[model samples]
Target: MDTSAPVRILTVCTGNICRSPVAERLLQAGLDQAVPGGFEVASAGTRAMVGEPMQPISADIVRTFGGSPDHFAARQLTPNILRGVDLVLTMTSGHRGEVLQLDASLLKRTFTIREFARMLDVLDQRAADGVAEAGAAVVPSTADAHDGASPLAANAAYWRGLPARAAGVRHLSLPADSSENDIVDPYRRDPGVYRQMEDQLAPAIVSILRHARLNAPSAEAAAGPGS
Candidate 1:
């Protein structure tokens, strides 16, 4: 798969108004900052609240994270939407299963948002090592390859290979504890529940953006000292 074309990513949840939209916007915002025209992000519900705006609290949270919730409306998930998407991120394990049921080939690309996050650091490290090894084999030395482009451009080229690297990541073992892989739905709950959702989601989203070679402000803060 030549990922040189725009990488289309879809986020799925039970209702489009809550988790999926939040993930959609955050991923978009991060990708916009990272690789301006390189990616596209969208969201849909397995069981939609069609034509509805994002839940007020969800919209508020989106704004808090520097995403505009303006003019947003819910849409139901469909096979057409999944047809060309490069990635599918779901809020829970069940949602991941639902997406896979719709299209089994998506199994290599679809993952619970939390599960993907947990696996990302290892995947990224593996990719970096692979890139370095390949570069060494072909170019002889990193110093010699610097003659053609600016460092930033070279860095971008390296990260652009991530989608392909992701195939290997998909085959790696996932953590055994399933509960750690889910993001509980907080719909109809109090503000505290929403906050809890944010706490869980914020880090996972950051990890994802990082794996995609995107900059995420929240992820940076979360990584403060050791990171």
Candidate 2:
């Protein structure tokens, strides 16, 4: 519930070698730059991609786009993975269901990546409402309230500062008229196809980051402590 306790976010795909890793790195980069220490990002595959490296072409594409290739590795999805993850961004609707099956409580935290981005839209609106009600002149803290303090209270305080309305759950629906519950898996496909999927994913990733920031209560809390 506390958005600030290093938001544990996981990005998932069929193979960790391509899309999931790419999304993980991009989201990490964005979070590091925009909201340092506020998020912890990781990636995993639905299928066992254990001990594999990123595909050569995937590496090439990541480098071509200026993404960090050093921090990626393949791992399979599991129920325990849902424990601490604040959010789970899967490649498709089926993946979302799979994650939920692993842990039904995740039904609240998991979503197809696009759906998560859409949820961000709602969170932003709620945060805006909080901002409006608190007025335009309040200045609040940007760092975690317990940066150097106790863990339990620090965590509770962060969650408490969040807009109670925005702190509730969110869900996703498959886009209409789309047979593909996911972006077609391009893991073993041609590099061009991977690139095409990349094109689709990149924008959605940015939107997710933007929404996270817009909805980020800590930033607003820093602006108005009691707000």
Candidate 3:
């Protein structure tokens, strides 16, 4: 059997009631099914409504995606919150700036969610294009060898190394418009904006979950300790 600490992920937005919470709940739900006990996801805002529940529209989106919106309260981002997180997904590049401002050490681990998704897509594409045997080849690390390891161990190593691997291929996939990398906030906005929020955020979430489920090693790889 493989035993390792769960990977921690944090999502960020402005008010915390909108984008980040939806991302947090949906990611947590999907990862529960995808990797099960392998990840933890949470959210906070830079200027959080700090105790407010998720906005109704955003809550709807979460439910639509098979996630829960009950019992959520907004929180402000802090260095303490950033501690021990393996990945940080922000709603906008500006939010990304704020996160890095709080903790520069997370520079490699933090990314605009859309940008991160695209980077992962690029890496996934590279593996398909046969540019590398595996996307991990882009970073050339001696770590993360999957041979005879439990599926959980393999999954952990692959994902822990993912930020660097994704970062390596990012330049190849820049959006034509920089704003394309951000999910528009829908706090107190009209229906169109809510649609825009879902339009932008859902695909990124889908892409992330897709990558996780696809890349997670199969059960056959769980060779157990001392195999």
Candidate 4:
């Protein structure tokens, strides 16, 4: 697990003014509470929505969730932005393609927000299987006595085995039912639709927060009571 720097996340959409900004704010609020300075979340649009404030309907929905949308403004997605981010989480599949086209290297790091959440779910399962295997094979106090291997070495072996077990998961592709999990675009839609979108986004943001906690090395370390 890399703990070298803060996790930089960029959320994207067709126009930053609406869906992307709302998703950004939701993610920011969750991260501010859960991870603090350990991660960053920002949003942009594939087309130019630069300098625009979030739509009034989106703002209302944000307010209902007790979040202030003041800090976010629309911006255009650019190669530089995608290049700088550790994760590019887009609002839709089309938005995902746009970010990848900007930089193909981003394919490894980019995912639709819900898509990444699902990947995190897969990773969590892998980690659990690792812990269980370690517990079963290595008697904690005796691991260092039988072999010349240190307890740390035994632990490293367990960790090393995880990636191979998780190789079967398709990280880049979301299932066909992903639409039910996605934050439906509310651009030019009624305020009711905006509210519905916010509802979908808020839960996905929470799931992403949980996933980051489970995976981020810095987050795991800071999780200690006095740290």
The parts of candidate 1 lying over 4 Å away from their true place are 1-4, 125-164, 167-173, 214-227
TM-score of 1: 0.76
Which has the higher TM-score value, candidate number 2 or candidate number 3?
Answer: 3
lDDT of 1 by residue, 1-227 (tens): 45245668899998898888989998899877775665788999999999999888888889998988888889989888899887788999999899988889887778788877766766657646664322334321212223443333333344444444544555563767777677778888888888887888888888877865532123233233444
C-alpha lDDT (0 to 100) for residue 128 of candidate 4: 72
RMSD of each: 7.6, 5.7, 3.0, 7.6
lDDT of 3: 0.86
CA lDDT for candidate 4: 0.64
Question: The CA-based lDDT of model 2 is what?
Answer: 0.65
Clashing pairs in 2: 139-223, 140-222, 140-223, 141-222
Q: After superposition, how far is residue 12 of candidate 1 from its true place, in Å?
A: 0.2
TM for every model, in the order presented, reads 0.76, 0.72, 0.91, 0.71
Question: In candidate 3, what are the lDDT values of residues 1-227, reduced to their tens digit?
Answer: 23356778999999999999999999999988988888889999999998999999999999998999999999999999999888999999999999999999999999999999998888777767767633555432223344566566666677778898888888887999999999998888887898899999999999999888867666655554455
Q: Which ten residues in a row have the lowest lDDT in candidate 2?
A: 133-142
lDDT of 2 at 170: 44
TM-score leaderboard ranking: 3, 1, 2, 4
User: lDDT for every model?
Assistant: 0.72, 0.65, 0.86, 0.64
Count of steric clashes across candidates, in order: 0, 4, 0, 0
The numbered model that scores best in lDDT is 3
- Enumerate residue pairs that collide in model 3: none
Q: What tens digits encode model 2's per-residue C-alpha lDDT throughout 1-227?
A: 44446767898888788788878888888777655676778888889588788777667766766668885679998877667776788988888878887889766666678655654566556556664423222322233442343333333343233322222424333346443335557776887898778777777788767754543435333443454
Q: Which of the predicted structures, 1 or 2, would earn the higher lDDT when compared with the native?
A: 1
Clashing pairs in 1: none
